[model samples]
Target: MGSSPDIVSPSSRIRRALWPGLWVPVVILLAGSALSFSVAKRVSSQTEALAQQHYHLQHQALVHLVLEHLYRHGNDVSLLKVPLAKAMPQHLSLRIDTLERHTKKPLLQLGSIHAPLARQALRSELDIGGHRSMVTTMPDAQLLKAPAQNLRWLVLVSGMALTLLAFVLSLYLCWRNHQQRKLVQSHRKDLKTQSQKIANLNVEKVALRQALNDSENRSRDLINLSGNLIAELDEQGQIGYISALAADIFKQAPSDLDEKPFQQLVVQVDQRRFVECLEAARADQDITQADLALAADDSEQPVPVTLRLKALTDPVRGLVGFRLSAQIKTRPHD
Candidate 1:
């Protein structure tokens, strides 16, 4: 009965058992941490290099087509023939800048795509058509932000190491299973934080995409509905694209008026004045208005009208054309 005074408590027995069990897990965690870190570092470099090369080849082709188009035909509406942006509207974004200080607007901006994290924007500069312009090509962000090829394996190994570590701790601390609860709670908190961040990013992307689409649609619809006849004149002041309103005003199909000198519509008395206006607008890159008599034919009386002209400058070529808006003059009847 004297030796029974030295009996061990339940807590002491649990503690003694837990300490001996932890050595194996501790060794495993150390080895897993060191090996995983080394592998991840090597894999990250190779992944980034491969991604860069893949993206380079994909976007370089687009840039080549863009520069070639500009070389063959100076910046004009004919860019529609290239059809790069039209084919994969989501995958490619193209921006062409003449780098001309006189004009602030870009020659063409075909798409809107955000660059992914940790990737450099793809840009190239070339002398095309005797003007130095820059072409920036953006690839689909989905490709850039895709998870690395071997990332899943690394995650699985790390998760296994952590799970074993947590298990050993739970066995080591047997007081109401305190260590296990702590590990589970920490993991849940981290999971919630990551989920919240991803949800927020998705919301922002949707809002921005929707806003851009709405803005583009509004601008296109407004241009078509504005009653005034809108036409783009080439370097020679020949109509390139005249709106459908041209049919009513000129009594000729818009296609029939293509390549016709813009001043040809004016009466004989105003031909010199139109030429003068062209020169002045080209020189100043300004808005100019003139009251002119437009004769569709001698069979019909000449219709008086006001012509508005604005210089359409190209990046490399100075005054490449003019954007003309013709408004039919309305007489106030007494």
Candidate 2:
């Protein structure tokens, strides 16, 4: 029987994918580091190597000059050595390990060598060979590597600048996040303040409505307590509101007379008096009096009443309406 293939779990596959993806960035970072290191090493090598030709030519010139000086001195070795050692460049160390042809003496060594010296770019030998061999060696390292040091300083400065730039970006993002939070908090506070104000205004509106209702009820009670008929009229001399006693005097339901003309309740002969009383109230008279006969539609005889009218004026609109109080009069004599 064939073995079944292994089934990978969903979570295992997801974890595998994520872990491998993480390595992509890691590999890129490693590549970048390796590239930087390679470039730095290349810069150092180039700095050391660029001037090799120049140094070689300079070395050849010095050798030729030394030979020329010796020939001019007629091969007097002691006379030639003193001035040559004094005229040598301060930055270089020169050594000649050779024997003279006839005297068999070892040649001169110039410049001090306190440390072990391994780096030497050029080595040569004089034609004073066969019996005596002359060797010359020069190290071309000291001031030639100054360019490499300057390159190192440039790398360090660039790294420091990039680090400072990253630090400043982090601070700016943090400050921006902080400012956004503060702005959100400010908006929330403003909304809360607006909501509180709206709630207070609603409370005030309810209080005003309750106060108006109370005042109307108090006025109704005062009129009922006076044992008289009272009616409130609009600017058109229409009954806007009336006491319950008005139903008894008008011989009709208060609802029936509501918004109906006041002239409808007066006798035909005295209906002119209704117009006169309304006009007097609109004229800003304090209190006006009239004698009128009140008769409803089905009444056979009219009842005589003394009607007193008062103006209801508004500051901006002048006279808006009137208030009428009626008292029924008894028959004077038999």
Candidate 3:
């Protein structure tokens, strides 16, 4: 025999089927990533611009100090021609050199973000190599351009695209797996139904076997009672079945009373008494007795019989019937 097909679980199949069409979130991720990088770049630009402005102010202050000293000793210093060697303090000179060094690289970086013209103005003012120049020297348009622009767009686009693609792919797979899971569940349901049907069939077979056994016992009861009279009555109170022993008792063959009412054959000397016993038995669900005198056309004398009536309830029609058994009475003689 050939090998069976590998069964795919319902969950797995569903994920597979639904793993497509997840592109929108990818776009959102791209936008968010780009925005984050842009924010960082803008913040950096603001900090650098503030530092550059502060340094310019400090340089202007130092120059003002030098000019004030020159005005106060302009004549004496001009005669001596001693340059205002002590005009700017040593600490201020050192601070200016440090600020210039720290700011020059930032000016070049800012030039990439701002327009070329503005970037150049910033660079010329900050790029004071060795001489610590604080004011703008030459305005180069390129220096006005902004920095980190390339990295911003690159990071934003790339991050968003990657995140979005991953999200969509994951969702699609989940959907497909869900579908597969449902399919597997359906198969399991079918298998359960089949198992239940098999159980039901087994139960029915057992019931049938038990019924056959009960029938055998009923047949045995019938055989042992062959010498005794038995009769079955119908819904209409007609005698429907008579055993062979009935023929000997009634002085007629069992077949003679078929479809005939037993009341016709029995002489009712006390009809009221017979009906009273029957009604009492029905109402109380107890046994009631009545004596009957029956005679056949061929018999010379009447037969004394003690009638015992028991109730039978029909399942389908809810009708009540009676099982009547009779025994011929024998009298004692000296």
Candidate 4:
């Protein structure tokens, strides 16, 4: 059989296979990771800059205080020693030197005799009592080290939190997408079923209309061929339709009898019996038969007719009228 040509093609099989909807989540995770890294880097740089600025300001403030002391006391190292020791942390060192302003000659030195290395120290220039002085402050490396480590840990935590949030959001989106796809599929299936039912109903309607038309044509042909008068009456006992033979029986045009009460055509003596038959047909929704004399305008004598009255019903309007089939009776004279 040559394996029936593999029934389903490889391409179609691949298309029917489940596709992992994880791509959206993967992209979101990658973007979130990149954003976290950028933010951490920026924040770290800012933290470092802030720390350096704080150190520079601290150095400036200390130098300014030392100059103020020099200005008030005039080279009195004794007044500054106690306050400097109390103000400066143990890991910091300060140096001050008084020089002649014009010549820049060293006149006096206080605190550290040897200047610390430039990398570990901050220096400032000041003027006190008409002499130029230099102030050097060296802050401890440990002062910035601890806070930097804490900031790094904080950045790491924030990045992790952001990554977790992104992951959760992606999962929710995937779930919602899956649910929406299912709902759409269900609605499509329902629509397909409804469409099929509507198509079936349309087919049935076409068949019924054709059948009704055929039936009506046959009934009309039969009425035309019969040697009798056929009439349709409304609920009020008024003639609605009469066959062509009505003109011969009533001695008037068929159109003239339309909307005329049936009692008008009945002889005065037979009117009560005709009315009773109509009432019986209406009350029971059944057929009732009666013999009645129909008065014709052209003859002095009345024509005898056997009337079959049946209730007329409509699918939507219920009992609408009655159908009367009348067979003419031959008289002895005729």
- Which scores better on lDDT, 1 or 2? 1
User: Is 2 or 4 the stronger prediction by lDDT?
Assistant: 4
Residue pairs whose backbone atoms clash in candidate 4: none
Best of the candidates, TM-score: 4
lDDT value for candidate 3?
Answer: 0.54
Could you estimate the TM-score for every candidate?
A: 0.38, 0.54, 0.41, 0.62
TM-score of 2: 0.54
Residue-wise C-alpha lDDT for candidate 2, range 1-334, written one tens digit per residue: 7545697778877864442234444444455455556666777677667645555665676677666666676544456567767666544555555554455444666665434235654566655324343546464345455566577556645644554565555556656665676688899999999999999999998999899899988988888888777888988889998888766665678888889988888889999987898887777568898998888446445768899999898889977888999887843221
The C-alpha stretches of model 2 lying farther than 4 A from their native spots are 1-146, 186-211, 330-334
lDDT of 3 by residue, 3-104 (tens): 457977788787565534444445555666666577657765665565456545644654454344435654222321233233332222211112435654
Model 4 regions more than 4 Å off: 1-25, 56-82, 89-142, 153-182, 221-228, 251-256, 279-287, 297-302, 310-320, 331-334
Report the number of the highest-lDDT candidate. 4
Cand. 1 TM to true fold = 0.38
RMSD of 4: 8.0
Q: Would you list the rank order by TM-score, best first?
A: 4, 2, 3, 1
Q: How well does model 4 score by local distance difference test?
A: 0.77
